[model samples]
Target: MYLEKLSLTNFKNYEDGRYVFGRQINVIVGPNGSGKTNLLDAVYFLALSKSAFQNQDAFSILHGADYFIIDGIFEENEHSGHPNRVNPDRVQITISLQRGQRKVIMADKKPYERISEHIGRFPVVLIAPNDTDLVREHSEDRRHFFDGVLSQLDPNYLRDFLMYQQVLKQRNSLLKLFAERNQVDNDMLDTYDVPLLDLGQKIHDRRKQFVEEFLPGFREHYAYLSNESEMVNIVYESEVSDPNFAEEFRHFRRRDTILQRTTMGVHKDDYSFLIGGVYGEAVPLKKFGSQGQQKTFVIALKLAQFDTLEAEKGVKPILLLDDIFDKLDDRRISKLIQQMEEGAFGQLFITDARPERTRELLSSVKADVRFYETGV
Candidate 1:
């Protein structure tokens, strides 16, 4: 699926702008704070119904604006029985979000009940300069990375994930109450853990499967991009701590009652990607490695994500890059742009401050590159 057109009003810094996207690649160039990232965020918000940077919807609206609208037009792929068939009637999805509060989603200009159905319909992978945090930060960061990546491929994972988070919140709140009272909340525990276990297992299994499939691409991407023979690893750390789900569920029974938290399940699962030399002197990439390695790591991970997503979802993902040229050196930038030319990316939205620099780096890629500068 590809977004044929995008229109926004009072969204972020764009007061009123319409972008005609290319099926292969689209580049948006502007100076800092000129709404380059905002353009990309508009596409992401349309596809996923969430901010690209995890920002709240309220913050997405232009300051002092009461409401904002994001409109997207989608066309199904040629492979889907009808090749190159644009819906005679455009499919319009719009979201009218009030400042920091109310939300209403429209599908073909009508209300949408299930948000997950809208996700893979126009799946996109957004890579910013800060994507390196997936590797450099703590396990929670990696877990979020894992969750974000898997959710696009598996709707079941997304649904169960929401359920798990909701139950976890209720359980935690109950735990806090129990601690205050010095007593067990048996009723709360029953309500929370029962559903938590059912949904959490589905989430955990899907994550385990995703990482297994994801690791190969990650290792390959890291090796090629970093130009190292060093080993890379992806492990799913789960708090289940038992062979049988039932056994583990029983093992935590007393604690669940006392603490009022599920305490075991996908909520505690995390991802760990280790990068070091092969059993010799471990060269820390974050510490000793040059900026090139860091840039390559982010690019490679972004590419690997696209590859892994193809297998899981049976669809190519849109690549949304935010100011990547500023973050990458010539070699890494050229290599990435080269891959996009080879069709590694189906459709890409890249932003850069210097149009000339972005053009030169992507020149050899033979893309339909458009150059733009910040306007007063």
Candidate 2:
């Protein structure tokens, strides 16, 4: 599948813009602050129903505009019954946001009952400069990334995760209310606990199983990118790993009441990224690795995400490479272009400030390439 056309209105720096795309490779070239990244974010929004960079939909609206709209046309390559006959399927996506109202997502002019239904219909893998935060930031970042990947692969996982988060929020609020009232209500708390434990255990098991299957691809991509310079591993750490999560939750109740917050669950889980240090000892990448290694690690993680999503969805995902030429080395870019030539990706959107360098890098790839210049 590939995005055939895109339209944006009152989005970020663009008051109104439209562009047609090539199916194979598209290079977006522009000067700094020219909305190159914003253009790519428009595509990401179409795929995921939310902005990748901005948390608020209001921020995406142009400064004096009250709302924003993003539209995309996707083409599916399915052959008809006749000999070598093709009747490509087209999917139209429209997203509109207005002030003080919920955003609307429509597929082919039909609105989705729930926005969550739009996810995974068109999967996209994005790699940006800030992705290293998955390694540099707190455990929450890691959990969010993992959850996002799983959500795209499994709809049930997304529903359960959402429900679990709702229960967790209610449980915490109840604890706060009990503290305010100077009361201890075990039965009231247990009401939330039953659903919490059930959902939490299910989430924990799925995440653990996901990681077990995910690590191999991650390691493989890292080795390919880094040329096996160092051995890296990911360790999944969670209260559920103890095999007695229900009892652990019970044991932590006293402290939860005292703190006015639930103390433990999958919410506290973390994926520790480790690299082999001297004498075969495992060390944290955050403290031990150089900047180059960190970038490579995150890129590898994204590539693994792309692979897994494609395997599960049975469709090649659209790839968004934001300012990657500036962030990655020539060797890595060459490796990526090699994959492009090998037909590893279906549709790719890349943004670069240097047009000549991007052209030089992709000159050897035998794919239909198109360039768009922004910030004019």
Top TM-score model: 2
Per-candidate TM-score against the hidden true structure: 0.88, 0.94
Query: What shift in Å separates residue 34 of candidate 2 from its native position after superposition?
Result: 1.0
Off by over 4 Å in 1: 78-90, 244-264, 277-291, 372-374
Q: lDDT at 335 for candidate 2?
A: 78
* Superposed Cα RMSD, model 2: 2.9
User: Per-prediction count of colliding residue pairs?
Assistant: 1, 0
- lDDT (10s digit) by residue, model 1, range 1-376: 6788888999988888877777776778766888888788888898888887755778888888899999888766543223355443356789889865767878877787877766665667888988888667776777777787777767788888887898788878877778778887566577876787778777777877777777777778877765664665656778653568756775676676576566667766666544564576555565655556656666666778888776655567888888887887666666676677787777788898888876777777866665434444
Alpha-carbon RMSD of each model = 3.2, 2.9
Highest lDDT model number: 2
Q: Compose the digit string of candidate 2's lDDT tens values, residues 31-77.
A: 99999999999999998988999978888999998999999898765
